[model samples]
Target: MKLTSALLLIFIAVHALIADGTVEGKLSVDLMKPSPSRPGYLPSPTKHPVLKPESAPAIVYLERDDGQYPRLKTNETAQIRQSGYQFHPSMVAIQTGAKVNFPNLDDEFHNVFSCSKAKHFDLGRFRKEEISSDVLFNKPGVVKIYCEIHQHMRCFVVVLDTPWFVKTDPEGKFSMKNIPAGDYWLRIFQPSERRIQERVTVMEGQTNTLNFTR
Candidate 1:
């Protein structure tokens, strides 16, 4: 009986190990420019430089076909600070129905607005040390953030349905660990609505290296 129990324990351990997996890849990104128009909010810049992946890394994630996942109900907030006439973290990706906290760290005022299909909101004139009410994203889509005070101030809020997401490094490398061995679709969104998706499989105790270019 002792020997049988030990064998059973070993089998369970190996099965658990085999059920764990990972996904890693180097993302070949093509980032786009932030929105350049905020009529009546600020002047249109004469020039706008397209962003590189190093400056604005891409957000890579695994998606569920059902378009639903267990999301947290807590009041935790993601911040987008206004400082030095720019929005820190020019790109953000979060689960659907998350609240984005916009805080103005600069001495001046900023009018934050977005016309994106995901969510449309305008936080009028956030002054120094001031913050707006939670900007809730109930849908899954890319939200373009801009400042009416500074036409050049631009950023993004990518709302997703799943929590399995990460931003690529400056060198365009990314990894996702502890994924239950299964089939999945790897995806990324950058610049604006542009995105890339691929089918992949995760295996136990193994690293899956998947690469993409676009």
Candidate 2:
């Protein structure tokens, strides 16, 4: 997205003027209950899998109001396809005013709908490879989506106001750069877990670190 790139350049220019700093942090979840946002507790595939259950990725962002952020409004669309009887990305974080395409890629019919507080709508059943409709996320919050016929099929669309965000790696680590010098509330959003936040002041050229454990 050219707009997104432009905004990054714009932020860089401003950061160069101010003493802006970078924000690098990590989020740690309980090993006993790796994911708490889903329906119920399910044992990890293997007891000693290559990656620990707590290393699951999560969305990390800054909750602050800069002059203007471009990701809030985008022509690029997000997709949540029902392929192999599951949502491609079970969870996603997008800015407000963005549109998400819910395409049915499976042979069986699927009806996608959400009853989350952020927004609500029902897209009647649609055929394979057919996109029932594009849902506009104008409100900011967590929107839970599901299939009427297939109750097991679910997706989470996280609508946000700030454009400065990135999904954590499997190690639960994330980084943010070119942020304006200021104090902000760093927020972390993980599936099946409550959001975690911490206050931190950013300084130019320096990398700040914040960590969560327990």
Candidate 3:
């Protein structure tokens, strides 16, 4: 009986470790129309003239109501490269406290800085050969980045407090797996549109689907 009880305890522990859920969804938005201009906001220039609906990507994340979540650290470093006088891949979503490397591939000097309330820093002037160190995003919110030398150069960094975050693909599809079963506030962030949030429940060993349209 003792041996049987020990085996049962081990099985319960293993099951608890694997008791997680998946969240998947698709985002629909009209990006062809220009986003409404806001006061004191300088629109960033894009290389393309006409934009498709999927051209504007969005970030989807889950946040707990109590503002408590597991702290997950990763050795991986996200990158936003400076090339062709612009910041390639203008949008990035990362967990809070992640590091982002801004590597300059252009021969000319670039100055990356942001006055956003979430994070504020200036990566002084540097060229391709003199790359600046990685920047750490410790706060949760949007950080709009710009180059002092080039007015058209702009990018965004979305720092999320929860580790369960994913960026929608060009087709506006996104999926997040291994999320512990619980109630969470599923939120979406889009540059051209207002933010959206809804309450969602994830069941153990099951998948939850939620779609957003704008």
Candidate 4:
């Protein structure tokens, strides 16, 4: 009876261990170069809050792009808002097959679409308070979303293959849970910007924090 009870307890523990995992990380900007595409090199808080007269734009606004579980059902929802003639939360990460909702908060009508490789669709000029559309990301990659009428308006939809993922906050902090203990290939996508990649491991009942630069 003692041996049987011990075996049952071990089985339960193993099941719990296999049921969840987690990954936490920090992403920081290592400004290397000023935005060459834009001129004047303006020094404004809205654009560039902290100006380094001698600081090259090699790194700035460093953030973490963490995806927790690699192999899992990816049925999720994400929000992309239209405001200030731009898409708020410019960079978004969602799992493949996940649906994304575009909410128009502007007074005037606006059209949103993505011609990028990962996903493509046109949510034609929608009116404020009447904004609604859904797009299922069938591919996993960096998708550039833009406004048809406003050439300067742009954003990014990062279609990921895994369901477990989270974008770091402005402070570059991210936390993910329910990941079965294992290894994963982590990646980050900054909208209309660049993608960063790294590898991580999630052990049973353990949380790990990572950092990314550039």
Which predicted model would earn the best TM-score?
3
Measured against the true structure, the TM-scores of the candidates, in listed sequence, are 0.80, 0.76, 0.80, 0.68
Tens digit of lDDT per residue, candidate 1, span 1-214? Answer: 9999999999987787777788888967666674566565545342333233225779999876666566544564789887777788888888887899989876677899999999999999878887578898989988988887677788888888887888888878999876766678888886555778888887778889988765
Predicted candidate 3 versus true structure: per-residue lDDT over 1-214, tens digit per residue = 9999999999987786579889998987434234324557564553434222224578889998888888776865799888877676777888888999999877677899999999999999997857588899989999988888665567779999888898888888999988989999999888664688899999998889988876
Each model's number of backbone clashes? 0, 6, 0, 15
State the lDDT of candidate 2 residue by residue for 52-157, as single tens digits. Answer: 2222357888976463555534575789877766676777788888889988776677789998999998999898887467889899998988877666567678
Q: TM-score of the candidate numbered 2?
A: 0.76
Model 4, 149-196: lDDT tens per residue? 555566667666676667666566777776666667666554325557
Instruction: Evaluate model 1: give its TM-score.
Output: 0.80
TM match of model 4 to true structure = 0.68
Give the Å shift of residue 60 in candidate 3: 0.3
Clashing residue pairs found in predicted model 1: none
TM-score of 3: 0.80
lDDT of each: 0.79, 0.74, 0.80, 0.64
The CA-based lDDT of model 4 is what? 0.64
